[model samples]
Target chain A: MIELKNIKKSFDGLEVLKGISMTFEPGKTNLIIGQSGSGKTVLLKCMLGLYSVDSGSMLFGNRPLENMDDNQRRILRREIGMVFQGSALFDSMTVLENVMFPMQMLTDQDEKSIRAAAHEVIDRVNLNEATQKLPAELSGGMQKRVAIARAVVMRPKYLFCDEPNSGLDPKTAIVIDNLIREITKEYNITTVINSHDMNSVMEIGDTILFLKDGLKAWEGNKKQIFKTDNEAINNFVYSSRLMKKVKEVYQ
Target chain B: MKLLHHIGAYLLMLRLVFIKPTKAKVMRKLIFKDIQDLIVGSLGIVAFLSFFVGGVVAIQTALNIESPLIPKSLVGFATRQSVILEFAPTFMCIILAGKVGSFITSSIGTMRVTEQIDALEVMGINSVNYLVFPKLVAMMLLPLVINISMFLGILGGYTATLYGGFSSSADFIDGIQMDFKPFHVFYAFIKTVVFAIVLATIPAYQGYYMKGGALEVGKAATVAFVWTSIVIIVLNYMITQLLLA
Candidate 1:
């Protein structure tokens, strides 16, 4: 489990995360959703330690991440995995090599074992055929799958995905969503995802934290989302024409 | 106050950059990879450069002197001194500033712009240790290798001049023996080592801080070339005055 306690962050006098507190439970997909520039990614980066919160603390399980030295942080990082917004695979390396990188760097396992492990994850992601191909040769969806494969190949205790389904077709997006959700449940890992897509929220949001202007506007599961009376969330969810029509039909 | 803090921050960053890599075993692998990339990868350019430089030095030195007072052997002596003191270290650095320096800057800059460096950090890998250390080692070591190669190439030029009848072999040998100074060679090695550190560090720093996107990476590469060239020329002058004078 991961907990954010009074997490406050600012950039150039603009507060991006205003004393936000939340917990992401293990074995479920925790979603942070907000409109563009509403501080969702900033909050996610803060959680990842990519940004230092101006005030407050972040805990992985019971250990505070804010004060750990680089070595200790690195030890924690070895157990954590992240899928970046851009896939972020090393473009120069083949898919197999990309997936194998973390294990090779962090582990003393021999090459043959690393290769087998990488191939296993590639097969798990259904990307066995594309293992030899570079990232540029893969489709956006395939690249995301490869990213997911790389993230999980080490069997990390925590997984974080940022805009995992961005730029993919709706069908492809759901496929990626289901893949992430299934992996989270299967591995019983603490998983956090950042997204604004309604489809993704509906599909994989076991726990959702909605941010509006750097404040936690609402928090609920997908099942309770539509039933909520929160005005800010209502404006956000119902502002879309398709969702507005769906709400009207349900009404 | 912020400026002072930034300066301190930069110093800390630089310290982290150098220290992290030294502690990791991964630095060895990265260094080997960079050696293969920077030294082995630029073989064609090195070969082409050696051939042209050797030929030009031999021809120019032979043409400039037409006096009986100066032995023809003195041409080879002058060429040897020029090769040891200036041509080998400075010219090789210019080539490297283009080939290896640009490569380090663009590659790391791209990694920065793409957040791959952040990804590495998140994975518990020291981005500097994992990325920059090997390049530093490779850049530092490979120049010495290239300097030796350039020395042999100058010898090849001498041999060519002998075979072409532009200078007699005995005269060439005598000139080399007469003009050779151990300090000149020592100075050349020292300059190459210093050049290696500057060539590796400056570009690596620029790329590590790259912002924007791919265009910014390109800009970093260009800036790396320009800055490294300027540093190399200035340092060459300073070192020459300090060592030779």
Candidate 2:
């Protein structure tokens, strides 16, 4: 489990995260959802130790992240895997090489063993056929799968996905979301996804934190999300044309 | 205050690059790749410049001298001095600053903007150690090799001049032996080393700090080339005055 307490951050005097705090439980998908410029990504980055918090602290199983030195933070970082929004695969590397990179860097394993481990994860992500392809050669959805494969290839204890379904087709987005959710459940990793996709919320948001203008506006699962009367979240949820139609149907 | 912060970051990056150089094997590969790209790839330019510059110096010196006051072959000595002391080291560095320096800046800057650097950081890898060290070492070592190649290229030009009847081979040898100073070569060698460091560090620093997107990487590369060229020219003048004076 991950716990954040009074987390605050600002860039050039513009406060982005304003004393926001939330918990991300293990064995479930904990989502931080907000619109563009709403501090969801900043909060995620803070949790990952990419940004130093101005005040308060983040605890990974009650271990404060802010006080650790570079080496200690690196070691902690090794236990976490991140899938960036754009599927930040190393373009110079083939898909197989990209997936095998973490193992090659962090482990003293032999080449044969590393290759085998990489292939195993590729297979798990249903990307076995495109192992030799470069990221540029793959479709948008395929690239995301490769990114996912690389992330889980290390079998990290904590997984972070930033807009995993962004720029993907609705069908492919659901597939990616389900894949992430299934992987989280199977590994029982503490998984946090930053997304604006309502489909993802309904499908795999076992725990959700909703943000509006850098503040924690609400917190609940998907089932409770639809039932909540919070005007801020209501405006965000019903702003989507499809959600509005769904609301009308329910009414 | 920002300058101090930048200096602190530079020191941090330098420490990371040197203290644990072999922590990242990929860095070793990158260094070797850069050596091939910079030294091996610049062979044609070195050969062309050395021959043409040597020929031009020989021809110009031959035209000005009257009779036997200076041996017609003393032109070769002047040519050698020009190539070794000024042309080979300085011009070669300028060429490399344009070529390898820009390449490093753009590639690494693109990686930075794209979050590949962050990926390395998140993977418990020192991005500087993995990315900058190899390129720095490669740039430092490869320029000396290119200087040697440039020297041999000047010799090729001497051969061309002698064969074309611009001067006698014996006279050429005699001329070079008369004007050659051990200190001149030493100065060139030291200057090349300094040039290599400046060329590599400036670009790598610019590249490492790049933010934004693909366009920004291009902007960083352009900035690196411009700044490196300016620095090289300014330092060349300063060092030349200091050493030659």
True-contact fraction per candidate equals 0.81, 0.48
Query: TM-score of model 2 relative to the true fold?
Result: 0.93
lDDT: worst 10-residue window of model 2 chain B: B19-28
lDDT of predicted model 1: 0.85
Complex DockQ per candidate: 0.57, 0.56
Candidate 2 runs further than 4 Å off: B1-12, B20-26, B64-68, B163-165
lDDT (tens digit, per residue) of candidate 1 on B120-223: 88887778767766777777675556676567657766866776677898888788889467877778888998898778877887798778998889998998
Q: Estimate each model's TM-score.
A: 0.92, 0.93
lDDT of each: 0.85, 0.84
DockQ of 2: 0.56
Candidate 2 lDDT by residue in tens digits, B1-245:
98688668766766777764544466667778877876677677667767777777777777778877776767777777778877788877787788888888988898888788888877777788788777777777755665665567568657767767778888887877885679887888888888888777788888998888888888888888887888888988999899999
Residue lDDT tens for model 2, A1-251: 89999999999999999998888988899999988999998998888887899998898986899888877787788789999888888988999999999988887888899999999989988988899999999999999999888898888889999999989999999999999999998998999999999999989999999998889999999988888999988998898889999888877
Model 2 residue A76 CA deviation in Å = 1.0
The residue pairs that clash in candidate 1, if any, are: none
